[model samples]
Target: MGIRNKLDISAYFVVGPENTKGRPVAPIIRDAVDAGFTCVQIRSKTASARQLIELTGQASEVIAKTGKSDIVTLLVNDRLDVVLAAKKQGIKVDGIHVGQTDIPVDVCREYLGPDAVVGLSARTHELFEYIKNADVSLIDYFGAGPVHETTTKPDSGLDVDGKRITRSIEEITTLSRLSSIPVVVGGGVKLADIPSLARTGVAGFFVVSAISEADDPGHEAANLVKTWNSHKR
Candidate 1:
């Protein structure tokens, strides 16, 4: 199946490193899949290309072995080359997630073709407006946040004036309603915040430290998924 078709964008989303606070990527992915997270983005910023490919390959194996390969979509953050490299090595990575400074979304679509999942980060209204005019056919989803201050991504959060630079709930709601693609919110999203975030009507939530730093990633993921699911009920 195509990545676009396979992805349940409304489900829980998880982003992390190969070794998150001593937790390995493979088991974390397994736990995520079992806990009903439908999307995983491998964001190993400091790892080399070979290391990323190897790590993603392991994650792909876990997804495949657990029989969630068709349902779960795995993406490599800002590394289209790694995604292509992994494919050549027989690892099934779904696509790439890019920031404004990364490759243009259209270029990514041209390289990966229509079926590849392309996610772009929209932290400001201006960025969201730009995304609104973007070619929806080439994009899968929009990742909007650091809903609160976050340490997961060193570059995330507010600017010099102490303003919340990321999209607010009102902005998210407007974007969710206006855009054709799904919108997933991220950054500093904890279990206690899920209920309120869910009310914003985003397709889903993106998590990192909340799960990666937990002593039990599986349980943490399960709780997150459960909370997300409850909102739909």
Candidate 2:
């Protein structure tokens, strides 16, 4: 509850060794945070636990160096074990972001304690049902969408029919209005989508390759932040 009340999710950057194109992840994290990304999720599908722990440590160091560590939040994607290991090692990771199939939200909240921020992912078809059935008090926010198709997370937002679902601005707006938890949209999100997405009254928008694979990560991150700020409610 502590971090959730003050969480600034305006520009959330999701990055990892896989997201960066043969580039060092720490520098990219540094650039994104320096450029105004308020939250970061360390996600990877290939790295081992020890490697993730090391990378999380490196990312924490860079965020701290930016001098905005107090305002910026760092989280691990789908890995409560990594979050625990990182914290045990003295790295300042803020919380965990789990997918529908990942560790359960209550387990995450129980393990991380009341202060930790726990995020859950949901697709459009299930969005309403989830809101009605889920213990909303256990989750701090919802991560929804693939505004467009993306290779970074190829199967994101796939519906029960197994078809890729691109959430429309209208659907997003409605979800934001209906849910009590903050919602952050991502998956193939581009610079052009920021203004409209921000105006949808979502807590924020997140990106993967948009910044991680950009020619100038910092400049791109800054522009995303600026676009969001210009239209955010």
Candidate 3:
């Protein structure tokens, strides 16, 4: 099966820098996986291509040691080159995620190949509609949110037109109904908000500070996953 098909995308999703709370990438990832996260996105706003690729290599090693490589998916944020470089180094990078100003979805799919799990971030239903109508197959899923305001990525829901669009529960519900692929909500998602967000019918939640800034990522991840699973439709 392809990486997209192999993934349980609805489970907890984690994104981070090279270090989480001063800990290295590999150990944090291992803890997250052990605690039940199914996806990890390596996001470095300032790292060079070489640095990102090295991080992927290190993270891949840690993931391999767990022997759950088949189950977990590792994606790089907005760096197609890093994904390709990691592959050249024999790191099993599953995919790439692009935003509105990054590489277009079709080009990303072309570079990464058909089996790779390409994701797009969408803050508005209009953008989501464009993706759905244009070429749904080119993308695997949508990262939909800033369900609440966030400091994690301070500019998360800003559009190309320079307007901020925070997706309401009703808006999320509408988008979920319209799209055939899974929609995972992120941004300012707290444990207490899971039950309410789950009721909107999204497939999963993406978390940054909720896990990365936690006292124990594994314990926090476990709690988030438990909350999500418990409130399923």
- The most accurate candidate by TM-score is 2
Error of 3 at 24 (Å): 1.8
TM-score of each: 0.91, 0.96, 0.92
Per-residue lDDT, model 1, residue 153, is: 70
Q: Which residue pairs show collisions in model 2?
A: none
lDDT of 1 at 180: 81
Off by over 4 Å in 2: none
lDDT of 2: 0.89
Evaluate model 1: give its TM-score. 0.91
108 Cα displacement, candidate 1 (Å): 1.2
| lDDT string, candidate 1, 79-197, tens digits | 98999999999899889999777998899998888888899885453556666687767778888777777777757755546565765778767777877888888888889878877
Give the range of the ten consecutive residues with the poorest summed lDDT in model 2: 1-10
- Local accuracy of candidate 2 as per-residue lDDT tens digits, 1-233: 35667888778999989888999999999999998899999999999999999999998999889887678889999999999999999999899999878888889999999888888896556877886577788888899888899999988878889987888999889888888888889889999999899999999999999999999999999999998998887
- In model 1, where is the ten-residue run with the lowest total lDDT? 10-19
Local lDDT at 136 for model 3: 71
- RMSD of model 1, in Å? 2.1
| 1-233 per-residue lDDT for model 3 (tens digits) | 77678766766555557336666667777888887888888998867899889888877777788887888888999999899889988889999888866988888888888889998886454656664675677888888887877876878777769777787888778778887887888888889988877888888888888887788888988988888889978
- Write down the worst ten-residue block by lDDT for model 3: 10-19
RMSD (Cα, Å) for all candidates, in order, is 2.1, 1.3, 1.9
